[model samples]
Target: KTTNMPERPFDSENARKKQHAEQSNNELDENSPTNNNEQSGDEEDDDENQIKGNEEEDYQEDDDEETPDFTDDEYGSEFTDDYLCPELMAERPQEHESLNNVIIVDNLPKVDPAKLEKLKEVISKVYNKFGVCRNVYYPLDKDGKTKGYGFFEFQNEQMALEAVKQTDGYRLDKNHTFSVTLMSEFERLTQVPSEATDIGNLLSWLTEPDAVDQFAVQSDDPKKTMIYSNALSQPILLEERSKWTETDFVWSPKGTYLASFHEKGIALWGGKEFRQVQRFAHTGGVQHIDFSPCERYLVTTSARPGNSEAFIIWDVITGQKKRSFPVEQGSPYFK
Candidate 1:
């Protein structure tokens, strides 16, 4: 107190040392057992935030990869709007509804089911002679017996008729004979006749529409009188002129011309004349004669016992001899 001492200025080194010591003390406090719980809590909060961010990223990826459902009716409704319509779905049928162009043979002799395949082969060969490939339907009954009939569908009506005329009553395998006729669609028609009940409506319904219109029984006697309805005023009369066993006869394509043949030569008649147009000579008895489709030629066949078997082709307009083909010895006699 007696001596005057100089006043000590603030020492910066001491202040720095005090600050460093306080920071070290704070760090030690955080590492202490009591503060460990608070430190772990902060670390857990950080981890939770990181996990939440990862979960959000996963959810976005899934949304991008997902596919839309297409099987639902709403999807179909939208898809069809631009591409499909009712008209496109529905298709129109063809004008010609006939199943085939050829003839169908419905009558065949009943045979053993075991021999069905052989029977079909024989029938096919007979059809081929008329220049046609046929489709045959042979169905069997429960007892494995042939129902005594089959169906043959051909490619052309002319060919079919030719086959029917040729092979009808034809003998196959020495024992079996067949009766053939045109197949009828009466079974498929809704309307039926009363007499059709006898033959199960198949035959009655199947009467040819054009045939019914053209031909009618004017008299009850089928063999004696038939009044044919023609487009002209004068109806034709099919009279049995001669008793020489006349089986079939047809008028020429033109109503002006008529032809009837017998064991004698071809007898040509006309609308104007009861006399013959031309008495053409054939080798044997004439079996069949047909006018060519173009009306230019006439085809005539003759069946004799041994030597006079021949088919003659003639010029229709001039009645001149065109050519002749010799038939084989055992060839069938067909008209």
Candidate 2:
């Protein structure tokens, strides 16, 4: 081999490295900042065009879509305006009649609780001579003494007017004289200013921004009952009364009336003062009562004499008896 060998090209590491360096430099020039910017601009333009094309397709699809028909269908008919917005269709405000049949007797003799019944009897005897006395009420003081003032309810406005005329300034004894006046007249004399009427509105609580709810509570004491406004912080008492009911109290279906139980009858109370609105005389003594759905009538049941249960239906507004049926002790309707 040492004698005369032909010349051959040999592969070297340095030669390969030089060739790779040249190719790398050429690639760097092609990907310089100026050229990269142009490529990126073209890609951005293509993306914007694709977005616009998608938006146009979506618009066309939306335009071709049909609106749903809901008229006369089960769901549509069932959810009419009256059903969706029931409050707008609510009944009108209830009629609040005058309290003409009630009279206030002032300047009476303040007496102890022991003599209160006797005093009421004496007052009743004097007033009954003019007309039938439906009810007599004497407000009491914290010390259980009479307040020297009373309310007398008569059969009608005419009877109340007569009682006021006959008893006004009439001397009951050497110490006390009757200063009788119609409740309506007294109200007129002591009427609050127009701006102050809001203070006496029973429904004013409904305007509270918090939209608080209210509930009534009957105390362990049969005669005590309280109305409370339920608030987030605590329950606030709106009104409370002792001797408001003899045994139990109930609210009307619409929460417009409060019915109080008593041995003589059921007394319906409402309005700002919670005064007596009507009286249903159930002489047999009411044990249970129910209001008609419309609140226009009341049904009261009592244990009558001779071991029978008496059910009486009454017209709520007129306080007149509608019908009466007696169930014997063993009858199916006895309870």
Question: Which ten residues in a row are the worst by lDDT in model 1?
Answer: 196-205
Q: Model 1 misses residue 305 by how many Å?
A: 4.2
Give the CA lDDT, 0 to 100, for residue 293 in model 1. 67
TM-score of each: 0.29, 0.37
lDDT of each candidate versus the true structure: 0.62, 0.81
Residue 155 error for model 2, in Å?
34
Q: Write the per-residue lDDT of candidate 2 for residues 1-335, one digit (tens) a residue.
A: 47876645554677788999999998998799988999999999999999999999999999999866766366466567768778875653222213688889999999999999899888888889878787788999999999999998787889989988988999989999888888778766686644422224445556789988777898874567998879999998988998788788888887768899999889987765676778888876788899988899998888666634388889997777889877666422333
Clashing pairs in 1: 102-154, 102-156
In candidate 1, position 21 carries an lDDT of 100
Per residue, candidate 1 scores C-alpha lDDT tens digits across 189-278 of 435434411212212312434433233232323433243544355656533344322344556664434565567667655432234455
Give candidate 1 regions above 4 Å deviation. Answer: 1-227, 230-245, 273-275, 329-335
Judge candidate 1 against the unseen true structure and give its global Cα lDDT, from 0 to 1: 0.62
Worst 10 residues of 2 by lDDT: 89-98
